[model samples]
Target: MVQRQQVVMFEIKKASEAEIAERGDLADKVADALARAGFAVHRDVNDASGALGAMAWADPADDSGGGVFVRWLIDPAFSRAAVQSVQQGDVESAAFKHFSTVTEQMYAALLAILTSAGFQSEDADDDMSPYTIRVKG
Candidate 1:
């Protein structure tokens, strides 16, 4: 039986700006991270004003924090596995550890990818949440 393990949901939030720009930087970062992690991920975006800017721009890492709004969401299934980590009682450790094991040192890689692209990432103080990413520009 394919175990029905919970999978974390991730997505880049809709970029809503009175000004118009595709705002696909977050998606690019996600693709880089996932690619390095060996997941063939992709991204796409649209301006709330009906502006179709960057189409299919590395759609990966979902609904998360960046630049006063954008965010890099980690999947919940992965998040829980990270929490209940075999290590137990050390969720933060497990969160990092879990993704690390799956993607061969993915956390740092993702962090680097996000930061280099003007996005800042912070691990949650509480293990119950996923890491947050903020964009500088």
Candidate 2:
């Protein structure tokens, strides 16, 4: 199988005025954590005219899952891979496990980083919800 790169993203939402003023510091802390994990990280501010707050992307790790799969599920580009995985059954589960593991790791690291920095992080549990986006913590 040809390995495909994956990128996992998370958004940091400002819960209060204090958090808003310290956006740069927060981004630095996040990037530091991601960088240490061997991922090339990038930070974007006011994405979509502040509707999405700040966004971060980490380079793909081995066998990780990215939005590309879900985004292109209907496209022919993914049909071959998807069909093969469906035939095997376990491939999807294995991929999800890998994604969850990395996500949890990053989530824990970010939680600790944010809390230590005196920022109150949200945990609404909805990825598309207005609440802050966390990996899984």
Clash list (residue pairs), candidate 2:
none
Best by lDDT: 1
Worst 10 residues of 2 by lDDT: 65-74
Candidate 1 to truth, TM: 0.34
Q: What is every candidate's alpha-carbon RMSD to the true fold?
A: 12.5, 15.4
Clashes of each: 22, 0
* Local error of candidate 2 at residue 64 (angstroms): 31
- Candidate 2, residue 120: how far the Cα is off, in Å: 2.0
For each candidate in the order shown, give its overall lDDT on alpha carbons.
0.44, 0.41
Model 1: residues with Cα > 4 Å off, grouped in runs: 1-22, 25-39, 42-78, 84-105, 115-129
